[model samples]
Target: MNSIEVEHLTKKFGDFIAVNDISFQVKEGEIFGFLGANGAGKTTAIKMMSGLLQPTSGTAMVAGYDVITQSKLIKRNIGYMSQRFSLYNDLTVFENMQLFGTIYKIPRRELKDRIMDSLARLDMTKQANLLVNSIPLGWKQKLAFATAILHKPKIVFLDEPTSGVDPIVRREFWNLIYETASTGVTILVTTHYMDEAEYCHRISIMADGVIRLLGTPEELKKQVGVNTINDVFVEYVKH
Candidate 1:
C-alpha cells in the first residue's frame, strides 16, 4: 500500500511558487528522500504533505488520509520532526516525553512503556532524567527522534533531522531511520546531505520550485555518469 500519494502538488506564497506541480508516491515501509539545495522548496513540499500548509493546487494523501479533507486524521497518523530541535530545554527528558504523550492523548500506561522502550533501543535509558539542555547535541537528537516516534505513528516526516550534526552521529541516525522503516513505519525525509540521499530507497531532487529529477540513487548516478551523488548534483546544477 502507498503510505504517501501526492499528485500535481503545488504551493505558492503570494506571487512566488515554492512547490511547482510535483507528483510522487512513497510505498509503505519505504525510505523516501527529498533532496535539494537551500530554497529548493523541499521544506515547502514537506509542510504541505504533513498538512502543516495548505497547497495552492493539487492533492495529497498521507497514511491513507486526504491532506485537505482529512488533515486532522492525517496528523494523528503521522509523526513529524522538523529541522529545529523541538523538545523543551527546560524539561527533563522524561518530562518532555510525557508532555508529548499527553498531547497526543496516549494512555499513561502505553506512554510509559513506549518511552522506556525508545530509551532502551537508543541505549539512552541512563540519561532519561537529564534535562534536554544538559545532553550533548547528538544525544539530544536521538532523544528527539525517540520522542517523535513514541506513539508509533504509521509514517514519520523528518525534515533535515541530521543537519548540523557530526558525521558519525549522522550515520548512526540514518541507521535508526532504516531500522524504523524496516518495522513498517514509512519515512519521508528531506536532506541536503548527498550521502544520506543515497541511502534512501528512492529520491526526488528539487530546484527552484520544481522536481528536476526522481529515481534511485544508483540510477541517478548512472544517468549523470558520476561516481557520487555529490558529483551528480554538481552535474545537475551545471546542466
Candidate 2:
C-alpha cells in the first residue's frame, strides 16, 4: 500500500510557482529520497505534505489524510526532523523527548518508559540527563531523530537529516531509518548527499519546480547513462 500519494501537487506564491504539478507515491515501508537543488521547491512540497503549508492546487494524501482538507490529521500522523536540530537546546535529552511525547498526548507514565527505551536503543541512555547543547553534533542529530519518532508516527519527514554528520555517523543513522521502516513506517527524506540518496528505495530529482527524474538508484544511473546518483543528479538537474 502507498503511504503517500501526491498528484498534480503544486505550490504557488503570488506569481511564482514553487512546485509545479508533481506526482509520486511512496509505498509503505519504503525509503523515498526527495532530491533537488537549492530553491528547487523540495522544502515547499514537504511543508505542504506535512500540513505546515497548503498547496495552491493539486492533491496529496499523506498517511491516508488529505493534504488540503485533513491537514490536522496529517500532522498528527507524521514526524519531522530537520538538519538544524529541532529539539530545544536548553532542555536535557530526556526532557526534550518528554516534551514531544506529551504534545503527542502519550500518557505520562508510558511516555517515560518509551523515552527510556528509545534512549537505550540509541545507546544514549547515559547521556539522557545532559543538555542537548552539550552533546556532540553527531549525537545531537541521532537524538533529534530519536525524538522525532517518539510517538511512532506512520510517516517521517527527514530534511537533510544527516547533512553535517560524519560518514560513520551517517551509516549509523541510516541504520535507524532502516530499523524504523522495517516495521512499516514510510520515510520521505530530502537530501543533497548523493551517497545517502543511493540508499533510498526510490528517488525523485526536481528542477525548476518540476520532477525531471523518478526511479531507483540503479535505474536512474542507467537512464541517465551515469555511474552514480551524484552523476544522475548533476546530469538530470542541470537540464
> What lDDT does model 1 reach?
0.90
In lDDT terms, which candidate is top?
Answer: 2
Q: What TM-score would you give candidate 1 relative to the actual structure?
A: 0.97
What does candidate 1's lDDT look like per residue over 1-239, in tens digits?
99999999999899999999999999999999988888989888888888889999999989999998888998888998889998999999999999998889999999999898889999999988999999988888878898888888999999889988999999889999999999999999988788898899998888888888888999999887989888878777555
The digit string of per-residue lDDT tens for model 2 on 213-234 reads 9999999999989899999999
Which pairs of residues clash in candidate 2, taking residues 3 or more apart in a chain or in different chains? none
Candidate 2 similarity to native, TM-score: 0.99
**Candidate 1 ranges beyond 4 A from true positions:** none
lDDT of 1 at 104: 90
